[model samples]
Target: MSPRLLLLCLLLMLPVAALASVALGAASLPFGEVWRDVVSHVTGGGRPAQITGIDDAIIWGSRVPRTLLAMVAGAGLAVAGAVLQTVVRNPLADPYVLGVTSGASLAAVAVLTLGPAGLLGPLHLGVPAAAFVGACATLALVVVLSRHQGTTAPVRLVLAGVALSYLLQGATSYLQLRARPDQLSGVLFWLLGSVAGAQWSDLGLPATLVVGCTAWLLLHGRSLNALAMGEETAAFLGVRVHALRLQLLAVSALLTAAVISVAGGISFVGLVVPHSVRLLIGSDHRALLPTTALAGALFLLLADLAARTVAAPMELPLGILTAVAGAPFFLWLLRRDRSAAGREV
Candidate 1:
């Protein structure tokens, strides 16, 4: 199918995916009631003000926030992956390829376990604030390490990211080992990732960042296309290679930081979603980026639904589900690439 047709199909399926995510959970609601409840909530009418119940609370309070966060976070991460892959000219590139996820995870773990409690000092959003700071610090370090003669080298950038990721992961592991039993479980769960505690208020920052960054990226499609071809080609095409790389790296970091802050360290959305989309619709950047966002949103919405319902009342971690699904697909991708290279040789 063409990109346009595929896009339309995805657009049509999105509402169905969203409704399924909202309606199916530990305690499944009837589809009709789910529809009615949603309509009432949306229109602010059908249900009487005096009548309130657990169902309404579950639908509006828990499910809505969780669903929204999953969708937005997935979209943001997928777009970040697409941008990084093009920016670095690496098929393996994902949102975490620059150590952003590791950095964010380390900071979040520290705040959750180490108990400086007031690290952010009075703001009380310590975990997220610290995570964002860690992500930015990692990005800055990676950029600096990869720079030579005032330009970033893609190979150096990837290597620096790999080194930093390992370092940060080790630190986070050490912190987890030292954590109190009560804290250990939470830290482990956070590292594995979940959207169970999502709130309506938690949606703002990530949604804004994802939408804004996606729009900005959509505008830079041509530049990204040139960059994908090579730095020299991008420069010849009048793309400010260094500046564009900087801008993309910053945007991707911000995207990853925002999503990880809200959703913990959910994996594979960044790694798998973009590749799946690109397979369905060729890698044009313009089409690839937007469709990747939609596909990411749809994929995670369904994944979260499965996460909640797969074991019923006992929720599975979002990261675990994604990894379980993503790993095999990624392996297949590698094999396919290897086979193609072999054929060429």
Candidate 2:
């Protein structure tokens, strides 16, 4: 299928997926009623008839925010993954795999527990700010450590990112051990990822980041394609390879930070969604980027639905769910690549 056609189909599917997400929760409202309620609420009309009581609250107050968060986080992480893969020229590169989200997680945990309010005041902005700082700092450190002479080797970059991820995680674990019993659950939940506590007000920054970063990425599609071919080739194409890498790293860090801030440490959306889109639509970033964003949003919306419903009233963490799904896919990709290499040899 044409990438544009695939993207259009995915774009059309998003609203359906969203509607299902909002409707298929444990409460089990009629789709028509759910639609009416949503339309009424969005249009600033009164609550629709016969949809009164807890269902109304469930749809408008709880489910809407949670669903929106899933969409935003999923899209942002997927686009980040697409950018990282192109920037690093590694199929396995992702925010989680490369330690970007780990860095963001560490910073967010610190801010939530240690209280950076002394400097930032509002915790909402402070957490994302702290996470963005941590992500960018981690990316810089990874680049510096991974560089041999003046050039970044992809394998070395991955190794450095993995090492840094472990170090950051170890520090986070130590802090977790010292956390007050009352605060422990909060810390654990954030680390595992959830959007259950989402509020309408919390949607602004992540949504903006996803939209803005995706637009920026689409604009640089040709450069991304060149970079994926390698820095030498990209530079040969007048792509300013080093500058482009820096730009992508910064944008990816910012997008990842915005996501982890609100949704906690949701993983694998970045890793899996982009690859899936690439398989379906090929690797043109112009299409791959936007389609990946939509697929990510849909995948996470469905995953959130599973997270909420599979355990009944007890919700599983979004990160755990994605890891469960992503790990096998990762192994499969590795095995397939090895087999392909063996065939070539």
Candidate 3:
């Protein structure tokens, strides 16, 4: 199948997946009603008289925002993952490779375990704010550590990220251990990820960043293609490999940090979506990026739907469903790659 055909299929599937996400939650709204309500809301029409206030609230107040956030976050993470894989020349790389998730998770977990006041004194930073700060700080640290002779080496970036991730994750574990029984659930939920409390206000920054960064990245697709070939080859092509690596790392990190702060640590969308799209579309960054974004949005919308409805009434975290699906795919990917390597040998 052509990449264009696959892209078209994904585009058509997205609205359907989004509709299912909004309509099939615990209360289970009818799709027709949900579609009508959504159309009315989007077109600035008054609410349908037949729709009750509670239904209006459910549609506009909860599911719509949640679904939109999932789409934005999913797209952001997927693009970030694709960029990271190219920057590092690592098939297994994902958005979390730079320790951004670890940093964000650690900060968010701290806020959950200890009250905001406990850590920040009178400043009282919320989990999202603190998480963003932590992610930026971690990115700065990694950049500094990875720099040698005034250039960032991909190997050093990976090593620094791994080291910092382990150290930060240890601290996060300690905080979780110290958390009260009542606090533990929130901590775990944040770590595992959820979009349960999404609001209209939450969508603006991430959606903006995702859109702007993705567009910027699309324009640089040629440079990314060169970088993926190898740093030496990219530099040989006059791509300014060092500057490009730094820019890609920064962009991908900031994008991942933005998504993680809003959506908590939703994993595997980054790892799974980009690779799946690559397998379908081939690795042209131009096509791969947008297709991955759409597939990711659809993927998370469905996963979130399952998270809320699979057990009904008891909502599972988004990460749980993603992990269940992604872990197996990851294992299969490893096995397949190993087999291919053996064949080459």
Candidate 4:
């Protein structure tokens, strides 16, 4: 589909999906009621607590925040993935490929099961902060292991990521093993990932990160394209190859860490969305970055919508739905990769 038509369709779908997102949930709400509550709220309704209607509470307080989180997280992950694929020059590169999620999970599980009472500060930052730390930690380690002569070699980075991934996973498993049965469920959510607790307050940092990182990426698009041609070519083009790689890595790591902290390591969004967008829009980072962000947001908003109402009363983990949805796309990518390899051979 043409980008114009695709964007137009998505634009039309976003509000409808957003309204459907606000309207449908564990409690059935009439469209008129939802519309009224939403219209009033956005049009300067009273305090959230003063809304005085249960449906409105769910709409504004719970579902809207959750749905908005889904969008931010999805868009963040997708853009981060695209950046990684380009910076690493590895088609298979993804946000989670570097053990960042595992690191975040380990930190969150520790906070949930072992931290001092009320010791974990900042709900918006607590989990996400842990995730950011995890991502940065693994990223630093991977770079340390991978670097030689101030150059980042893709194979070493991947290997280091795999190694840290196993180590972090091991640590998380140990935490799960040690937790009380009642405490186990909390750990499970951290492990599986969720947007069960999204609020307006939670979105500020992430939104800033997404918009800022996106702008930075677009500004650096020419360098990114140069890098894509190969390290030698990028250097010849006067792109400070190492500095560029470090900046991209730092930005991508922070972006992924922020969302995974808030959204719980949503699977395949970063991996699948960028891959799909690249297939559709071509590999020009200038064009690819913005398009992926919008598409990713739309994809996850709908996924969160489905998560809330899929079974009703019982909530579905947003990550579960993303995986269920994105895994098939991943398989297709693998198949395509194999076909391309065979053709080359």
On TM-score, the leading prediction is 3
* Pairs that clash in candidate 2: none
lDDT of 4: 0.80
Candidate 4 per-residue C-alpha lDDT over 1-345 given as tens digits, one digit per residue, 9 for 90 to 100: 466665677678877877788778777767777777777778896434534566666888888888788888888999999998887788778876777777777777777667633224554345556667767887888889888887778777777887888988898888789999999987787676678788888898888999899999999988998998888999999999989898999999888888887878688788888878766656778888888898888888887877767777787887888889888876786576665435421
* CA RMSD per model (angstroms): 2.3, 3.0, 2.0, 3.1
* Model 3, runs deviating above 4 Å: 120-122, 330-345
- For model 4, where is the 10-residue window of minimal lDDT? 116-125
Query: How well does candidate 1 score on lDDT at residue 43?
Result: 93
RMSD of candidate 2 to the truth, in angstroms, is: 3.0
For model 2, residues 1-345, the per-residue Cα lDDT tens digits are 688798888888888888888888777788888888999999998688778868888898888888999999999999999998888777778997678888888887787677786324675447667877777788889888988988777778789999999999998888788778887888888898988888888899889988998999899999999888778888899998877887898898889888887888887888889887776677888788889999899888888888988898888999888888777875675566664324421
Candidate 3 per-residue C-alpha lDDT over 62-136 given as tens digits, one digit per residue, 9 for 90 to 100: 999999999999899999999998887877677677798999999888888888976567879888888887888
Off by over 4 Å in 1: 46-51, 116-125, 330-345
Task: Please give the ranking of all candidate structures by lDDT, highest first, separated by commas.
Answer: 3, 1, 2, 4
Locate the minimum summed-lDDT window of 10 residues in model 2.
336-345
Tens-place lDDT per residue, model 1, 140-245, is: 9999988889778898999999999999999999998988999987897888888899999889999999999999999999888889888999999999998999
Model 1: ten consecutive residues of lowest lDDT: 336-345
lDDT for residue 340 in candidate 1, whole number 0-100: 37
Give the higher-TM-score candidate: 3 or 4.
3
Clashing pairs in 3: none
